[model samples]
Target: MRFMVMVKATGYFEAGIRAGKEHSAAKDAFLHDLQDAGVFQSAEELLPSSSGLRVVFPPGGGAPAMQAGPFLPEQEWIADYTVIDVDTEDEALKWVLRMPLPPGQGEHVIEVRRLASGTACALDARAQTMKADLQDQLSLLHP
Candidate 1:
């Protein structure tokens, strides 16, 4: 199974400066361990929304408006994320729970969600056969 683990930010724009060094070190170490485990496929720490772009449509059929910067509430910020492949959702959740948060922060919230399945790989029979073989291998390995 594959899961996307989201770490939500409580507040931001220099929030980390307030969190002490111990917190930073712990988080770094945990990330390192995750990578070392071979479970990590990809991971990235997000910049505060202030650095992004947002396009909003006008009330009518006029051209859509464009704007940038911190567009929403601070509570919506995501601290970081990791995409992991594991045996099951349960195992993925356990991995997410092990990640550490910055010091003085509230409980680090990690959202683990399963990746979608049952998508056709291609229109060709070879592709279909390959997908079936892969699925069968996974089932046998996990079971």
Candidate 2:
């Protein structure tokens, strides 16, 4: 099973306070361990929501509306994410429990969600094709 583990954002993170060396080291070590165990697939830390935007589709079917960010209610933002291939939800939970706490001494939340896999449905196939086309376009730009 594949799981997406998301580290929730806090007020401190929204303010752009980066992880301290100790916290970074701890996280690096933990990720290294997961990699060594062949469980880690990918991981990344996201920039604050201030650098992002939101596209909301209206129910009445006009056009998607864009909302610039510096979005409030910090709890709604995600700080980072990790993708891991694990045997079971219990295993994923165990790995999540092993993650280091965020720099400041306060409450933190991590969400783990299973990723869908196997044979693609019609919508999935369309999405996959779109993703491949986008990747090809990106390669042209970068390469």
Candidate 3:
């Protein structure tokens, strides 16, 4: 199974602060283990929400609007993530437990999510036709 392990953003994360050297070393070792096990696919850190943007799509096929961020309450943001192709959820959890967090954050959260492959869902005939049409439209934009 493939899983994405997400490190939730805290205030420090939004401020672009990271954990200490000891934590980093431990994390490095943990990443090395995951790589050696051949489960590691990619790891990345996201910029703070303050530096990001949101695209809001209105109801009933209305035009989308763009909004800049520094969005509130921090908890809704992700700071970093790792994608792994592991054997089971249990194995993924074990790896997650080994990841170190920035100390003194009061409360820290990590989330694990299973991603859907092949356009994220099983497509019916109509859905497949919709996808092809969407792609055809996009190709017109690019080509």
Top model by lDDT, which number? Answer: 2
Clashing pairs in 3: none
Model 2 pairs whose backbones collide? none
Q: Which stretches of candidate 3 lie over 4 Å from their true place?
A: 119-143
Q: Which tens-of-lDDT digit does each residue in 1-143 have in candidate 3?
A: 88999988988878877778987888888889999998887788899999999998998988899988878873388888998888889999999998887677657889999866654443446778999999999999999
- Higher-lDDT candidate of 2 and 3: 2
The superposed Cα distance between candidate 1 and the true structure at residue 98, in angstroms, equals 0.8
Clashes of each: 1, 0, 0
Off by over 4 Å in 1: 13-18, 57-63, 117-143
Residue-by-residue lDDT tens digits, candidate 2, 1-143: 98999998887888998768899999999999999999987889998899999998999899999988878773389999998989999999999999997656467989999988953242435678999999999999999
Say what the RMSD of model 3 is. 9.0
Local accuracy by lDDT, each model: 0.72, 0.87, 0.84
Q: What would the TM-scores of all predictions be? A: 0.65, 0.80, 0.77
Runs of candidate 2 with Cα error greater than 4 angstroms are 103-105, 119-143
Pairing residues by index, what is the TM-score of model 1?
0.65
In angstroms, the error of model 3 at 113 is: 0.8
The C-alpha RMSD in Å for every predicted model, in order, reads 9.4, 7.3, 9.0
